[model samples]
Every structure is written in C-alpha cells, then in structure tokens.
Target chain A: MSETNSPSPMRILYIEDNPLIAFHVEQMIEDLGHVFAGSLDSFAELQKQFASLEMDGALVDIDLADGATGPQAAAWLQERGIPAIFVTGQRQVAAEHGDVSLGTITKPVSSSELAAKLELFR
Target chain B: MNTIEDKSLPALDQVLILAPYRKDADYLGRLLAEHEINVRAGARIDDLARMLHPSPGVLVATHEALTPDALATVAAHLETQPSWAEMPIVVLLDRASRPDQVRAELGRVWPRARLLFYQRPVTAVELVSGVQSALLVRLRQRDVRDHIAQEVELRRELNHRVKNILASVTSIFEMTRRGATSIDAFADDFRGRLGALDKVHSAVFHSEGDTVSIAEIAELTFDPYRLSGMDRIVANGPPVTLSREAGTTLALCLHELTTNAIKYGALSHPDGRVQFAWNLSQDETPELAISWKESGGPDVEEPSRAGYGTRYVRSALAGMFGQKPVIAFEADGLRCEARGVFSRVAGNQ
Candidate 1:
C-alpha cells in the first residue's frame, strides 16, 4: 500500500479477448491509482510488441483472442522478471498456472480487490 | 439429396439368383426379370462372393446351388453386413430333399439372415410376393438408419449451442459487476443487461438460420425507453441482416449506449435528443456506415479519462469492424461514427 502511494504509479498491461471486459477492467485499474499501459488481445500480439511495451506488471485473462494463451503469456512475462497476475473468470485455469502469477483476481474484478492484489506487484 | 445418395447404402432393389445349373439360372433370371425384379445370376461360387460387394436386396438360391463353398461365401457376406442390414435369402428346395434338415442347417449357417423357404414347383405369384415384401423391409431399415444419424448430428449441434450460451452469460455477469457502484445499482444494472442479452438471444434464435435483421436489434434495445414514453431517441436503418455474432455484439453495444445516454447524455434531460442511423453503400466494395449523435443536452465536455461506456464503444467497434471508430465529445454533444466493409460486418450471409 505504501509503494502504491509513491509519486509514480505502476504501469499495468492488460491481456484479454473481450473488448468490453478489457475496457471495463482498464478503468478499474486506473481508478486504483495505477497507469493503464494499454492492452493486447492475444499472446501473439504481446510477443510482437513485448520489447516496446513499457509496463511494470501485467493483468492476464485465461482466454485470449487467439485462444487459451494467457497462461503461456504469463509464463513468458515471468521469464522476463516482470510481475503478472491472473485476472480471469476461469478460476480453475488460473489455479493450474498459479506458479506463474502473483495471485488470481476473479472477474468481474472489484476495485478494492484489484487495489489490494496490485500491492504484490509493488 | 445428391450428397445423401453419394454416401447412401447400395441400391437394394436387385435380386441375386445363385443357380449353378445353367438351365435353372436362365429360367429363374428370365422369370424374375419379367416381373420387373432386377436379377443377377451367379454361375460359380466365386461369382456369389464377388456379387456380395454391392449387396443385393434378396438372394434366390436353388437347393443344388448350396455347395459347401457357396454356402461359406454367403455366410461370410452375411457376417460382414452392417447392423442395419439383414440379407434376405430365398431357398428353393428339391422335393426329394428333406425340408426340415435343410432348414435347420441353413439357419445354423446364416445366423442373422431372413430365410424364406419355397418348395420346388412353387407358384410364381407366391415367390414374387415374398421377394417384394423382403425388399420393403430393407427400405424401412434404411429409413431407421438415416433417422439415427440425423438425431446424432442434432445432439452435437445442441451441445455446442448450450456451451456457447453459458459462456456468454458468464461474460455478462462479470462485466456487469465490474461497473456497479452499490449493491442496489449492481442488482438493477445486472438485471437490465441480462434482460438485453436474453432478448437479443431469442431474436437471433427465432430468425431464419443464424442471422437477424438490424431493425430487430435496434427495436429491442430501445423498447424499454419507448415503453416509458420518452421517444426522444430515434433509430433508422436499412434492412441489413447480421450473423448471430454480429447481431449480439451490436445489441450489447446499443445497450451500453442507451444506458449511458440515460445516465449522462441526451436522454438524461427532457430537452435532449439522440439520433442513430445507418446505410449500406452500393460501390464495388460495398460498405456500411453507422452514426450516433446526441444534441440539445446540457453542455458536453470530455471526461478527463474515458469511462467504461466510451472505452467499450471504441474497442468493441474496432474489433467488430476491423477499424477504429470516431468518437467526439463536442461542446454541445457527443458524436460517434464508424464504417466498414459490408460483408465483414454482416458476415458470410
């Protein structure tokens, strides 16, 4: 909580398939005093722009535009020393890939829950 | 129908006559042919096995034709028959042959066959009628096989549809809860969104095939407002049909827009108004254009950051149309417009 209160906010990238849910979660992320680092619909797109994306953490959904690649994307991010969390409706899927993320925030995500889980990234 | 025929069971109207004696083969083939019953003769045991490849409707065999080799070949063919098939074998016995012994031996050899026994010097009328009845039974079995296949296909389609609907409901619940401010607000908004989804689902289901008209989507979205007698919102468009996916997306988008309007934009004030219109171009590469405009409301100003409604409109439209939509927050109103290839938006009709 102290780290979140610092002058600079954490930049969080979103990986989700549905645009409506992504946008809704984007606003929630920003409302929790974090910066929205933009969103990618699939793991392939994230790979394409992984180098240029300036983000401190990532919020991933289990399903993506290109199918079930979110867990793989989180693993890829973890390999780069970037912190990630599962922001998905599929709890079972997230639990299966639990080792790759800080924690799971089930959808529809609440403001307080998101604000609390984001502390782990700090 | 042509594809059905291509994969259908073999033509089952013909009768195979296994009469090793040349005179008997000629006489029987001629008699059956005169009665309009197609007949093929097997002069050797090898010919009987070869003819079984394209199974005949019935087999007419003379007692003399029942050599051990011929009987074995027929038994093998009967064993390989599909569960839907029961090859009809009509055996003509010689008067000197013990009928009971032959019947018992034949029954043991052909376990699943329909055996019709006729004594020698039998009437043409009785033999022809028996063969005709056997052919009718084969047709009934074919119908049952076809019906079972159709039911299997329908069950698969139904399972797929049920899974998709459950996923959709999950998405709606998640998204609705994300934007609620209070418990009461959450309940109301969730119910409204679910109602919208349910309405659109039924519209698509009842429509011919997997498509629905644009007008139907618009009407359902605005029905609540219209029933409340606040006819300030007006939507007009050509009769454009959309795939189930496209129609559902549009319906949800309109729901978001309608809710936003009532909360902050045109529909929030008595003097305000909103206009929604769309048209399809006739160019070589046909395109569809849709616009939403709000006016006569309190002075408008862009929020410091896009809210859920505005953000959803841009992102969802971009995904559906493969192009970014133009959304402007002017001093007097909010305006949004988007255009894309007609085929892309409508999907493969």
Candidate 2:
C-alpha cells in the first residue's frame, strides 16, 4: 500500500476520553495521509452513534470518558466489520483485548508508526 | 472495658438457648427478653444446628442438652469460627452432677469455645451477668471484623485512584509530545499540562465530597495567569459543582484555551482581552452554558487548518458536554461556546 499506486486514504475514528490527545491523534491521522472520521470519548457514545459513524478503521484507547469501555468498543466495532487498532499507553489492557485490533501502538505515537499501522486497514 | 451500649461496638445481644425441657427454654427466653436481649431457643440437636449459622452472641444449654449428637453439631459450628471468634458456651449443671467431669468433656469437644458454668441453683442475676460478659466479647470480635473489611475497601479504592492518575499523566505526556515543535517547547508545554492536572487533582482531593465546584476549577486553572498581572482575562460563573471526572475534563479544557489565547489569540497582544463566563438555566432540563470570547487582538483569520489547541478545545468539550462546541475564528478574535445538561456533567443524577 506504500507503493506509488497506494490505496485511497482510510477513514479513521478515534476513541479517547482525553480531548487534547484525541485532537492530537486526529492531526496525526491526517498527517499519515488518512481521513479523520472523527472522535468519540467513550464506548457508550460510540454505541449510541455507531450507525451514523463513517469510518474505515478505528484508533481505540483502553480507558474512556465512561471508564474502561474501550475494549468493548473495539469488540463492537469488530462485530460490525470495522477494523480497529489499539492506540493507548495501557499495553497490558490492550494486549488483554488484542484480538479485536490489527495491532497495538503505544502512546506518544509517532507519525511514521501511525502511517505504518494505517496500512492494516488497506 | 467498653459497655454493650457503646454505639461504636457491634450489637451482639442475641442469645441462643439449647434446652430439651420446654419449661426451661421458656423461662430462659422470658428472662433474657426482660433484659431487652434478643433470644432464640431450640429443644432438639437438629434445631440447634439449624440456628447456628448466624452464630449468636452466646449459647446457653441445660445439662441434658449435651447429647452426643448436639456436642458434635456444636463442635462443627465452633470449628468454622473465624480466628478472631471464640463462641461463648454457658453450661447449666444439675446440682447432683460432677461439674469438673462435665467441664472437661465440653472442653474436649468444643476446643475454642469460651466455657462458662452455672450450677442448677444459680440466681437469675448471676446467669444474666455471665451472658452479658460473653456478649461483650462477641461484640469486640465483630469490631475486629469490621475494621478488616474497612481497611480492605480503602486499599482497593486507593489502588484504583493511583492507577487512574497514572493513566491521565500518560495521556497528557503523549499528547503534549505530539504537538511540540522542539525539545524545549515540549518540556514547557508538558510541564504546564502536568501542573494543571496536578492542581485539579489536589483540588478534587481536598473537596469534602467526590465533587468539586466549577468556580474552584476555573480559579485554579487561571491562577497562574492571574499571578502574571497581565489582567487581560476575565472569568465569572454561577455556583456549580462537578464530579471528579467532570472537574478534570473542564480544567484541561480551560488549560488548552488559556494556552491558545497566550500563543495566538487575544492574550497574544498587550491590548487583547478575553472574557470567560458561564450560566445555569432553570428549564425543564437544567443546562450549563459557557463561552470564551477574545477581542482586541491582531486581525484574526481562520487558520488554513485547525491547530492542536483548537482541535482539543472542540473535541474535549464536545465529549464532556455530549455536544459539539462552536469555535469561530472571526476577523477580530476567536470565539468558543458550548452548553449541556448540568446534572449530566455534574454526575448528580
């Protein structure tokens, strides 16, 4: 997908409770040459708007505004045929729910690393 | 030395009586009831075994109540007693029976029980006093159990809070790094964000309840700016309290706004000024409305793209308020406003 004739940009949704982090990640997603599908702070919010959210993939944090509902959100997204990547500082928590995501990207995520992970959706 | 009436002590006033004779059981129950002690009596070994689950304060038995089956049942119950417990057993001996023989037999069968003996001709006053003392010991044992439970609960809560704080710090660190242009910039911004988080944490910690006042959060967030004596920022709001989570979110949002203002908005110029205010409504669904308006700065033009601070202000407030906040980069200055159900943000209902 990194070749000259690469696939179109993926629409990536972010699930994070911290707004600053979410916005920063949104910018990073755009920097990686992908579409920022938007962000949700909790799994409950995701569930409420699941039908309306247009995304090709997801970046999920282990914790959310509604406590630890990120894992459930990933599972819910996976069930809907939407792929997800765990983007969080909590590697242990992400590892525990690893099956739902393509891979894990630890926090303080780099642009290059995020660019590489976005290929999983392609 | 504490008495049974001490409110802090657990109430161990229930007496369990095992007597094969109906008259004896009835008399004992009536006597204990007169002293305002709750009493339960059983005339059979099976009945006694069935009533042993709650582990009454004291067990009183007649001489004939010590059938082999009853002894085994009582032994089994005492075996399961917690290390802190020693179920007190009072045995009423017939005057003709050998007291030492009966005491030795009971001691062998019920190893951990505190044994009290009363001869058949004993006075009611003496029996009641013996039972009361036994109940007091039971109450003390209960106190120990309660203390252990409370300690365990507190430890669990402390661990949970520590984990949450660490996670919040990690998020702040990662996001700050993402937006930094240089090492010095990263360190400065990171430190400021951490300081903001730490301030809100302490404020919430010191709050009497699990909620902090909105004014308290705003005051703390803007305190450093106020200390610089620039005096360009103004903040005023009604008395509104927020849950610990809501307080943390609001504090971080304010931090983002203040930093942005200092860097590129109203606070960027000497003559620039900012107004921060909020109001509570009394409609069917009570709402809280907040606005941040900047003016008198250099001619503001909408950036070709949204910056980290602007994006955070929009998304964070949206997540917290459950609605998208309006952010307008006007020709003169920046304006941001949002509103949401007050009870939901406060987490009161």
Candidate 1, residues B1-349: lDDT per residue as tens digits? Answer: 2123435567777888888899988888888889888888755777777887788888899999899998899999999987978888899999888899999999999998899999988888888888788878876766766666677777977885665566567656666666668889889887887887788889988985778888899999998898998799889989899877667778887888888888889888899898999899999988988888988888888899776567778867766675779999977788988888887668346
lDDT of 2 at B199: 92
Instruction: Give per-candidate clash totals.
Output: 0, 0
Poorest 10 consecutive residues by lDDT, candidate 2 chain B: B1-10
Residue pairs in clash, model 1: none
**What digit string (tens of lDDT, one per residue) describes model 2 on residues B172-251?**
77777766889999999989888888898899889857778888988898888889986888889888888887788888
Off by over 4 Å in 1: A1-122, B1-133, B347-349
| Alpha-carbon local distance difference test for all models | 0.81, 0.83
lDDT of 1 at B63: 93
Per-residue lDDT value at B202 in model 2: 91
Task: Looking only at chain A, give the TM-score of model 1 against the true structure.
Answer: 0.92
The C-alpha stretches of model 2 lying farther than 4 A from their native spots are A1-47, A55-122, B1-13, B34-36, B46-50, B66-76, B83-86, B93-117, B129-133, B136-140, B347-349
Interface quality of candidate 2 as DockQ: 0.33
